[model samples]
Target: MNLNIFRKQNVKTYLGEDIKFSRTLSAFDLIAMGVGAVIGTGIFILPGTVAATTAGPGVSLSFLVAAMICALAGMCYAEFASAIPVAGSAYSYGNIIYGEFTGWLMGWALILEYMLAVATVAAGWSSYFASFIKPFGLSLPKAISGPFDPKNGVYFDLVAVVVVVLIALLLAQGMKSSIKINNFAVILKIAIILIFIFVGLQFIKPSNYKPFLPYHMSGVIKGATTVFFAFLGFDVVSSSAAEVKKPQKNMPLGIIGTLAVAVVLYMGVSIVLTGMVNYTDLNVANPVAFALQYVHQNWVAELLSLGAMVGMATMMLTMIYSSSRLIYAMARDGLLPHHFSKFDKKHNSPQISLFVVTVVIALGSAFFSVNQLTNLVSFGTLFAFTLVSFGILRLRKRTDISNTGFKVPGYPVVPIISGLFCIFMMCQLNKDVFIMAAIWLVIGAIIYLVYGYHHSQLENKNSKAEEA
Candidate 1:
């Protein structure tokens, strides 16, 4: 059991293996993808709520804190991605640096991150979608339009499930196809965000920022912990290393570059938002639109709502795409049943994996509210970041590894700081979320012991089979 659990796969095997992922994404496409994932519901929906209840005008500072943390972990991820350049992101890094058991845990945690991201974002999408269609005389019933959260009185969120399934259907078309749609939606959403900032900036009341830290340090810290979900998707960009063109150069560019763009946008939007309206008054489901309503810009509010829905749609698409690839990668390595790795010959897509991921996300979104889903996603993501950061320390110990890709600047110091920061943020999460994550990990360990341990390809192979 010890031998099976600690079995490691060499870098040479991953590099030389025919991983079946297409290489069509350029550095720019990757940046766009990263931007697509980073700028989602957190910016559009949570800004108001977090501002009113937690940070007040200091939400901008909260954005700064979260960005700093993400940048550190993003750097570590860049190094691992550059060295490994595989589809599984942290799962791949963990397998090569820490061994099979750790890899399985990372993979399992990532499933939580991506799946909850989809659910929470879909629930967000439904809110904006409902608003976007309100003027058209379309009213969705409460029973089926919201999650089964007793706190919110919602029994099920039908629109959320529909959207996830729709995106999964789109994913089945192929990665190139799904990304093209995502790229377009991302460009549109960015434009809408810019419009909001520029227009809202003109009406800024300097007085609204009077007590910027109204809730003080604890509030800002709480805001940062909550809004960290905004930064969740940036690292998922690394999951596309296997599909990226010139990944050695593009992977790091995408990961770090996305964080930079997202941080600036998040800070700018929050500053402008709080300046336009008192942070207390901005805590609505559609805060951006609510702010616009204050200026009586109904047209702009409608467009922003529409843009938000489209933006969230792209986010759902990207997460589903990345998550399916992760599942496919794990399945291919025999850490899961081989059938899940099956690809459609016509589309060259992971049909079974996509189907499985879509079904799970749909069901989760139907039952869980945005807040519940976001908590789980945030904790799981922070935990994954911790391990990924720690893995960089282990990877650096190997002298046989190639020096072809991007390296994390500052080495051990950066990863050490990154890991510590991640663990600190993990501690900030709601205790209940931490408990749920623990339960999820235990389930993953059981699955690994029952199936993954015996089926691991590396376990059945000789160590001399691959060269460095």
Candidate 2:
């Protein structure tokens, strides 16, 4: 063991270069991406489930708790994103502040987060798409509409495969074009959400909220942990720092704005949902739509089904984009093959990386069941959040580096709270999640030792300097 894999990146040198990505995204585009990433199955589904199982009518408070925890991490992300303005998000921050091995580990964990997230969301999207089209007397063959399971008589999820590939192609068209689609999906989803809120409000029963803390405050805290996964996508926003204009200014706004918007929407839906239907009766896969159906608003429920598909689609788009950028950043650092970093000059997109990610996601969504592995995604996300939160403390102490952009307020307090909360949430995960995550980390370590360590550009540069 050389034990020399801990060489840190020079932040000044990394940021001083003209990274190949085209800075075409405005603040609005960044915020839209963040919103698109964060507001998927979470708002449409988790409220009712958490309310029923954990906090009853107090799920609204759960959203607030989760949002506060996310904000702590979100502020840390904003600081690093604005200051670094790079593609790898936490991975890059880890490299600059920690070292090569740590960076590689963070990147590997993010790969799990983004890749599995895209697959899981696509699987969920397939169900919604099927349900959305079912009432119209249109349906895919049973065998082709779900994952391959001989016992279940399901062959493959063609809808999931098709949608993943379509989003991948959209991303291959580059950020400018793909963002338009994301923006459209986000607007449609939010409009449908607003429709649900306003329409559902007319049916609110004051009595439904009487037993607000049926499970007590502990349940509310548990509900916060349960719904914490809903806030996962906002971090993907920071992964786009390289492609944003005035990243220093826009990055913080995008990150903080995403959490702000998502929390408000989440709370609104939770309040209306619990008020419209008794919390005990709200536990269903499609809670928002079901709430409407309970109130005899079938038409609006139908509209919400459409919204669910759109919402999940937007999430897949953002996840795929973020995953590709992460790969590009890792490859650029020579942790992987340099070929993966090549961009299409015309479109300014990492077409090769996009293709690879698309294939994996399509295969996972179409052929494999990811329900059990979804918790792994949550664990990976919290792990990244914890590392990013602590990475800021290391970054701020370096006199050689300076960031005039965003800084975490209240100094060490915010990041300390952020990191500690993330760890607390991580502990809340099932034991199996930790086992799987440990296995994943071990595999990453083997790869790093065999390939990443030897191929690293920084290692090579350091060796040359030593020889001189």
Candidate 3:
């Protein structure tokens, strides 16, 4: 087989291919999907944990920091999705501008992200659901309530698996049904967040914010790194470009609009949370509900927990949906088995790929603890975001393609800054995550060299007599 590291995919031809998707998602549905994905455990759970442990009252500033990074990266995504207007999100963008090798690796990293994201959020949902029902004495035993935690000795989280299976079945029905559920879930999540912010606001004590930066700038930055996971779901919107109506216009709208809404919601929650309860006491698993307990709003607290479980459901569904597309896209390119790309004629959904994703997510959620999976999710996303930031620069240098949709305002500066910010936040992550990511990338490399390199559709096309 010939070595072709720099072989680029043709976006126009790829878009023109017979591969069909039910293009039914409007900009609002895309935004709802993005919102559903972004506003999950990160908001309902992480704010209090980060505030108590790292940033204190200044955790709101951490949201601001992460939002800045997301805004820059989101702009780059908007440009790429608009210009390419295909499935596979960053992986597709990288393939068009960088090469097959880079694209393969990006898709591999994305698979890591989406899988871990579903697993982590599912586990989080289980814990919150358990907490919500414990007062009524309907909670499961320790053996089933949580996944395997070496310290706690719990094993096989039953709720997590059940949720993943249900979501998988829903996705198999098609995008239309899954997205309708997502829209409803998004509205519930936003309403719950608003309820928390407004209701908690009346109980805010000014003294709680006396030393807003109690943990200092380093702590704030650390908090920003931890909470960056909250801003991940918007990119999943881009992954659905092929199924979205008017991809060129609505893709940017969904990406940017989702980020704006997420930032405001996160910041508002952080302020109200710290003010309602002392930051030091907000480190529990159900932080929002824990804070609400102080104000004697047990019913609202229960509702918040219910909303969190629902929010995580949307996140899980979107992540699984996006990751399955990555598999389908790569399989269609012959990097994986062709059957993985096979879509149902009636539903236009990749049933086989969705099944594979569901199985992996269920297994991961059953065994891995949320803390163990969160770092992997964060590392993979930051790595993909870095590549996307760099890909924008490479795409702009190309003169062959007709560029359309939203363009990044500052060209090289925006992407350069976005790339640097991604790197900095990545550097702040635990070293173990880097090691794990490196190991995953190495495995992907091995598979590509042993199989994908030889069997790639592009290689086959290059050898065809007509092409010659």
Candidate 4:
């Protein structure tokens, strides 16, 4: 075993190089991007489904719990993004503070998070699209509307696959264009949410709150674990640190702002949604729009269904963009082929990585159901969040690192709680999720041993310097 795999990367050397990404993103742009990513299928679909299956009306409290966990992790992430300002997010942070092996695993886990997140959202988007068109008596063929379940009559999710490919094409146009589309989608998404809240408020029966804790506290905790997927996108903002202007100032604001906004929207929608309809009846794919239709607000429901599709498209765009950047960052570190590091100069994007990611996500969306994809995504994200929380504690002890960036408030206590909470959430996930994540990590370790260990750029650089 080459112990070089456990060697830490030099922070100063890593920070000193230009990574070739465009630095055109402002704090507002970063916020828009994060907001665009955070408020999609999680809000549109998960709230009602989680309520019906796990929390009942207690789903609102579940959102709060998930938000607090994310806040703890978000502060840790803010400190890292401000100080490192790199594209790899947790992968780069782990490399500098932990070691090559730990970094590789974090990057591997993030690959699962971003890729499956897009697939899960695409699956949700397909359902909303079906709902949106059905008002005109139009419908997708039964076999093409959902996943490949022979017993259920679903052969392949053609809509999900098509939407994923379209988002990939849009991202290939580059960051600036994608951000513009994200901003527009975010504004429309927010407007639709507000309309749902106010309009749905008038229809609340007040009876839905009776059995709020129908499944008890255990169910609330379970719902928090399940809906944790709603909070996954805030970290994607950290992945954009390399592209932001004055990242030291903007990164923290963007990351924290994203969580703050998303939490409020999630809680408000969860409450109004459960209030307007019985939790048992809210388990359908297009929950938000369905609530309005239940109250005889058909026109509003149709409009909301359209907005949901637009909202999810932005989420897919941000996830795909973030995933490609992670691949680029890992390749730049010699953990993968250097060819993956090449940017399309004309577009200022990683076109090759985008293509590879698009294929994987499209396939996942076409074959897997949303529920299967969602749990796996939550597990991958929690795994990364756990590493980042503890990685910050180690970073604080380094004498060579600068103290100029944002620091997690309350220091050791905050990060400790953050790390423990992530583990607790992981425990709350399905046992099947545990099995799948273990398999994923085992595959990652094999790749590291075969290729990354031999071709490591840092190892080669250090060996050459020693000979001199």
Candidate 5:
């Protein structure tokens, strides 16, 4: 093996990657990014569901356990993102350490994660929109609202499709404007949640929390899976690695600080909301609104509903933003069409790439409801994270990648434990989700064997032709 060739390939990053991101983001901005991504359905909807379905009012415990898992994985990612400080987030990390196929696979799985995430947010928005407008007895008909669910009894969701496209158009506009929009959305969402905590505190019934750990050990495990979705948005912080100023120092601070605030918010909301009504009667589909409705606070529910709809819009925006960037990076390396990698110099965004990404999202949302579309957002992310955690441990041993400012505290132990935690949560997923995630992996494998292997940027066609 020629060390010089290997070094040269590493130097190019397989693309004329430019330093476009401003290192101006402080810890606060990164924390805002995490909050924007994490606050969606998980906090607004899932806690009630987790409490009712698994923990029985003891959902606060479930959230704490889930936060522990998130903390472990977040530490590893913070280390990698700071060390690499490049575009593509985990996709770049995997590529630099594991080679082309693994890298592309990570990037590809990320698309699935973000797409499904957007779909879920769309579904959430649709549900909240219907709930909000129902007061005047005006709401979307079942055909548009319920969204074709044999299990939950839905019948086609037009609103969801519309929402996905709307967010896509916003992101296609570019990053500066997108960031401003996201900032506003994040503030609105946090304010709404604070209102719920303050106004709903008086309604708490101590009897509702009788058995805090209602399900005990089994319940805790179930709650972990339910609330794991809340932890989903923290990784969006890493997706901004390409744009961060001093990504090394800022990434970890952002991840830890954001999760800390998010956890406090999650725990507070779960406790107050469940205490307002027995966890048994809380609506899993639209948990927070249902809880507010339970306490006869119809006005609060309506207010939260509007807030939620706007918040979901921001959620879709941020998810699409990071995912589209990953696709652009992957395309530039020839893993996907080169055209998809073209950045709009004026907008400083991958405009063509976003167009294609939005097309896929629009089509998916047009057909699938949040429930039926997929439950594997958590799965793909978990898999990618497992790669990143392990990658940090592997890369740390090689000096070439050690120029990063921030590093994980426990080295082999921290990353190894994080990898284990990822697998644990993955196993907790439903069998159907497990099978579906496996199928996605198989598809990635096939693509790698057929195309990625032949066109591998690692083979260095430019340099190879020179040698020939």
Candidate 6:
């Protein structure tokens, strides 16, 4: 009943509550899931925004810059995920290495990022849906297409809602089915993107690359932060660490391999895009489709639209998967509740956690703008990455358990530099993002006091009850 009580727990007790997801994933499946979640949105969608607003032809460089920062974070995640082999991505590591209070806030920050991220991807999905619907002379109403908030000039987004519902159904079924679907989705989208790049390459004009950093010095920073969205899916690889057959070896391969593949594809597609058409002419939202149109490959644009629709669906699918697992880790440790953290015995999935995340994502997708949601996703990810980088240093000093696989080669220096890079990117997001982040942290603290603290495992409640 005391409001000012504090409790703490160690890793062993926390791991006891998990439903044993140890047999469901392989290195390939883990990598495929990362590819499935990350591949679609950034390359196919964000290049245009970078091209139009930041770097123009130099958006390719932006992709590389973002990838560099992620490369560091990815390695840190692979190391942590492999050692712990748990479902909670940064949140679990933060708790074990940093402390519970820090971990809770990280978990809370993640809810906004992933929830809005799903909504953002759903909005992107909606645009592609509208594009596909257009050929039949069918167009959805503006109000149905999106909410006219009037404040920002929009309120509801129907297409995003539809996408969220369909994906949630798939996710609620189980991780195995979700992984299988993601494998197919990732392959199909990659094939489609490759088609865009290969065909678009033959038509490159060279002039488009002339004034690359169109926005000047700051453009690189702008493009770097914007393109970070493309690099988003890498963390999902780490989230499934608990399920991997060989967490130590497989986690790194999946995280590193998936990110390497994505960055290459992003750069290739960016080059083909600007080469085929001047970056200035690209639609920030619909660049790839438009680039195909420039080469008289309008039919491919149609296919791109369809691929994109499917791509975003899978991204939302995996993102929701990651979110549920992270939250489940929190809840099983008494941060939320047994209900939110429970797993399905038959399906071997976090059904309750997944369902809660799905509802929040669906509602957000139905209401928010794409631009508004993108910042939300980016803001928290940078902070989480910074924590993971710092966790590497702390975990090393605190635990004598030598990591068996994917160690950060340089120890303190690698993580220190990575943490710095993460900070650099975090500062690049609009100043408003920091304000939103602060408010969320305050709310998380309030919940920790009123709920998580009392329910905590550290109190040895059963022993005390027997004595009473």
Best by TM-score: 2
TM-score of each: 0.92, 0.96, 0.93, 0.91, 0.89, 0.90
Candidate 6 stretches greater than 4 Å from native:
1-8, 137-144, 148-158, 211-222, 283-285, 459-468
- Per-residue lDDT tens digits for candidate 6, residues 1-468, read 554332234555444544376467888887778887787756776887678767888888888988888899898998888777777888778777777778877778887777778877787788778878887999876767874475654668888887888888887778778788888888888888888887887899988788877788678777887787678768877878777787788889999988888888899988888888887788656788777776799888888877777778777888888888887888777879868877788888878888898888888778766675477677788889898998888777756345677788788899999999889878877778888778878888999988987776544632443344
Q: Compare candidates 5 and 6 on lDDT and give the better one.
A: 6
Q: Clashes in model 3: which pairs?
A: none
**Model 2 poorest ten-residue lDDT run:** 10-19
Off by over 4 Å in 3: 139-155, 215-219, 459-468
In model 4, state the lDDT of residue 368.
81
lDDT of 4 by residue, 1-468 (tens): 535678877765455434577898888888888888888756878899999999999999999998888999999999999878878899989998899899999999999989988888899888878877786899988988998898988899999999999889998998898888888888898998888889989999899888889999999988888787678878999998888999889999999999888989999999999999999998897788788888899888777777778788988988999999899888877889988878799998889888888999999899987665567777888888999999888988988777687999998999999999999888877788899899999999999989987877876554554454
Q: In candidate 3, what are the lDDT values of residues 114-169, reduced to their tens digit?
A: 89888888887787778778789886878777767767868789999999999999
What's the residue-level lDDT of 326 in candidate 6? 82
Task: Rate residue 458 of model 2 by lDDT.
Answer: 78
lDDT of 5 by residue, 372-424 (tens): 54568878888888888788777787666555477878778988988988887
Q: Write the per-residue lDDT of candidate 1 for residues 125-218, one digit (tens) a residue.
A: 8877887788899988777888786666668988889999989998898888888888888889999989989899999999999898999988
Q: Tell me the lDDT of candidate 5.
A: 0.76
Give the root-mean-square deviation of each candidate in angstroms.
2.6, 2.0, 2.5, 2.9, 3.9, 3.5
Q: How many clashes in each structure?
A: 0, 0, 0, 0, 6, 7
Name the runs in model 1 displaced over 4 angstroms: 1-3, 140-144, 147-156, 213-222, 367-370, 461-468
In order, the Cα lDDT scores of the candidates are 0.84, 0.89, 0.86, 0.86, 0.76, 0.79
lDDT of 4: 0.86
Q: What stretches of model 2 exceed 4 Å from their correct place?
A: 16-18, 460-468
The TM-score between candidate 1 and the true structure equals 0.92
The Cα error of candidate 2 at residue 248, in Å, is: 1.1
Q: Is candidate 1 or candidate 6 better by lDDT?
A: 1
